[model samples]
Target chain A: MKKYKCIVVKSQTYAKKAEKVLSHNGISSSVLHCKAGSVSGCGRCVKVEEKDVDRSVDILKKEGVILTGEIYGL
Target chain B: MDYKKTVYLDNAASSFPKPRSVIERMNRVLNENTANPGRSGHRLSLSASQIVFDARTVVADFFGISGHEENVVFTYNATYAINTVLRGLLRRGDHVIISDIEHNSVLRPLVAMKKDGISFDIAETFESDDLTVSSFSSHIRNNTKMIFVSHASNVSGAILPLKALGDLCKKNGILFCVDASQTAGHLPINIREMNISALCAPGHKSLMGPQGTGVIVISPELNTEISPLVYGGTGTDSLLDIQPYVLPEYLESGTLNTVGIAGLAEGIRFCMNEKNAISSKISSLFSYAYSELEKIPHIRLFSPKTDNVGIISFSVDGIDSEQITRFLDSEGICVRGGFHCSALFHKKALSDRFGLVRVSPGVFNTKKDIFTFIISIKRLKK
Candidate 1:
């Protein structure tokens, strides 16, 4: 059981690019299975710690990646 | 495998005996993940995708391309990278300017595109910074879209005034593209400082990577959308039939050279770690070789005595270059002969008929290796 929030992306490309931006910002994340009720072309999503959720979303948005949903308490 | 004993001076062609870590990394990638990167979400596929992204990020940081690691597009060689920029960005009726001494990689593509209603002009270098700048500036027109020049001539190892030209391009509002195949890992090139719009380089030469790895560091400011050179699966925008309009994914289509890029990342790491000291040592060795070769008679040296990258091109007066190359081959000294793949430069060097023997020393080459090469040249003069 993971206690982090999720950033659902349409594909692995956006997910990876988001991960790159987040990693450069000193936020650690893991590529885990996408959350339930997520619409994605790819199977994976990035899981970031709950405290860093807002910053992660901001970074992803800055990089032009669209976040479909944010699932909590995974 | 033991290139330490062989006098390998043909680094400009393709580097021999890549770093052990490069080979090991490639082997690991080939064994661990052969899946298509960014296309699938499986663990192995994601791992392969990460290596590709890592190579891009490493290249961007190494070249001082700010914040847009996604703009670093990987290709099979510098030739492909150069062609991508030339063809992708140029439009009909556009005029492109190129330096007089450019590799066939840049020249051939422009020549081929002439059929598409594009034209080009050549800017001659006079060994003076102001004169060279004027040469390029004089050719700029309203339709002039870009300026493409090699950072250093592969045929002569003469460095171009890149920063001055970059400034000129900036003032003129034209995209400045540099073919860095000869100087990428050899010289310190900060794309931001140079105001370069695009920098294309091969991973095999001074970058210490294996063949089949090349990169293009593009500026985010260029108006050119850079239509995809090869379009297939970008892994993003999967439902859309059209190609993605992003930075790397747009240009990078089809399956990437995952194993080669894996090795290339380590190669860039090695270069980064060994930057200033390694460049100094290479320059010292080149100076030694240049001086020693100058002592030989009936030789026409085309490169500068100092201030040159590891490459040096020269010809023995009245002696065919092929004969010298064959003799050197027998001497176990690996150097390239005949044209060195730059006919324009060979013509300017006045050795088109006779060709030129190009000696591109690698960082791994030693003073003893250069001494042996000079002695061999001396023997051939007899």
Candidate 2:
């Protein structure tokens, strides 16, 4: 069983941007389609390693990415 | 006849001899990745989607809408972008204001919207920025919802006062929309600095991109209010049965022109790298052409002496404007003639009968080309 954390964003655009920001901040991340009823409302979300969740959120926040929901485990 | 010998001066219509990077980028994309962006999760689709996102970022940065790249919506051309902004933003009984020098793209949509109870008034532009701003201010009504004007005239090459107009709109609480067809790459436009709500421009003009690519950059405040002009699938929220409320995907429907956008991105990059030089080079060429054309006997120059966006509008004393252009074409010197699809401008300038010949030089053009154009027009005097 793989453990990962996801940060939901408004759309794929933000997801991709967040991915870039995280990569620049030394965090490895990938964008994934959010499941229905996710905080993003079926848009795309950025998934990252569970260890890098807090740092990734902080990086995206500092970069002004509108984070909709909390970090949820998947 | 060797094609290289011919000079291209119709850049205001569409830039010719696109930047080599733009061409090479488009070719590379078409050869490598033709997948629809954001339509699939596969590697190729993701690559295509990244290309679009990269282009959107470049466009946003170019227009000073950085960090809000999602607000940059891809359309087919400035016409479609203008239609989307005009139709989507204005509702019944909403009065809009436009400049007299608008292309048919802005004029026709507002004309059609009249049937839907939306009305628009044209504010006359003048050589003086103060008078031009005052004219636009005078047309503002209580019901005025938006003030849409061209950043520069396509006919007379008259550059409008965008900052003052943007300030006027801000003071009046009216949305400012600009048609940047003639000045996108030729001028520096910052959406935030200009207080622009919607900025529309084609990629093929000063941006030096291929045809079939344009952008509609929206302010964040108008994101939710401006509805999608075209609705279909955005690859997200598929099961919802309604268009998803996303930033770009909200306004952007259908598959985007990936190859053209890739080319557009490279084009914008080229503009960014040459930003310091593009304006000065084009200005020098415009000055040279203006001085040389003013020297031609029987030539009537319509373009302003200064503050032009690299276009020279002129007419001959006896011959028709189209006839002059036709003659120039025979000499392998390309230039646009006649109304230039700007009847209102011609009517206002009182040149509707003879139209006007427009010689718009691009960044690729040289003083020698303008000299060739001058000598060709000189031949017409004989």
Candidate 3:
């Protein structure tokens, strides 16, 4: 099984919300404790498997999360 | 009359209808004396230096710091000031403790620094009323090198227990840094008494100053060796290859926003003279609006009843924050929507989906504005 890494950049205050969104969608993801460099300290990002990247992004966007950027491939 | 309309409720982001004195002073500086401050011994340069020095003095006095103009370093904005401290002070292996309601400006820098081996822990805010200082003590670790938190939240307008936190950090021998972006000019702050080692604030917000001007006040104790994040000609020690080992000149390397600083000086002067009146007016407005909003059963207010500034955050049941903001905008009302740069707080508060509509009233707002806003919100409920 190939594992794809998807970075979920968001506000740290929204970390639990993002986690919940991922879990509800059954997409296993881990919160990546890094700052979104481009936005001058906007929020936190999460990392998930590449296979679940599309679903995860859709879920987050559906939930109105502001995604700064994302990177794939673990 | 044009003055008879247009409600400006976004003061927490930046003030509107800036004092005429602020504009006049800025104009004076630009027209008569616009020179590189502290760069030359010429008369124009000396005059520019005097303007900066006077502004620094006003900032120092306003914040309750003793006369030490050199300790006040100017920056582009509060975010820049916070980044300077977080990057310069914290090193690998350092442990920092922050609060749950911090703005992204504080959170992001620390998050980035975590990659370099710095670890962070957050103190959970009390679920109910009263965010007391004792709540923060439990989160402090033996390895905690710094205790950083905001003086007041930009999102919810909840004032943190800075005095108590300052005492705890002082007793624990930890560096205490405060982000005063939301409360610097509107609320009273005493850096000396609070034991705040470094204080960061945006001059444009409550200070009624123009954008592009911010300040970082460093404690004299830490002034000896705080590294400069950016290094260049500081208009002093021109021959030295290294950054100046002084107070402000060390951190202030590039050309400053002189015009903005001049405006900020006047703004601070106006704030100082009208602090009590301005606070009372803002509080009255918030109190009236909070009471009215509480009556709207579907709306959940995030700011505490007491100890809140002029800002208020609330969510309308089943209505998207953007939609509500747009509706209010259509009524000629201004409000901020979305996560308000505090995504972590939104997650913790369970408001991540729609975020919250933040309405911050300034001194220029009136009773009619609040009444109209309430009517607009109530109409949305129906």
How many clashes in each candidate? 0, 0, 11
DockQ each candidate and list the results: 0.35, 0.44, 0.01
Docking class of 2: acceptable
Best by lDDT: 2
Tens digit of lDDT per residue, candidate 1, span B1-382?
A: 4555578889888877677889899898888889988776678888888888778779989999755667788999999999999999899999999988899999999999999999999998867778989999999999999999999888888889999999999999899999999888888898889999999999998898989999999876666788767888876655567775666878888888999998888998889988986788788878888888888878889887655777788888888889899999888899988987786787776789988899988777778888899888898888
Candidates 1 and 3 compared: the better one by DockQ is 1
Query: Residue B8 of model 3: what lDDT?
Result: 72
lDDT of each: 0.83, 0.88, 0.80
What interface Cα RMSD is found for model 1? 3.3
Candidate 3 chain A: worst-modelled 10 consecutive residues by lDDT: A35-44
- Interface RMSD score of each model: 3.3, 2.6, 19.5
Q: Which ranges in model 1 have alpha carbons more than 4 Å from their true place? A: A1-13, A23-28, A32-45, A48-53, A63-74, B1-5
True-vs-predicted CA distance for residue B6, candidate 1, Å: 2.6
Worst 10 residues of 3 chain B by lDDT: B126-135
lDDT of 3 by residue, B144-206 (tens): 889899988888898888888899999998999999999988888888888999999999999
Model 3: lDDT of residue B193: 85
**Deviation of model 3 at B46, angstroms:** 0.9
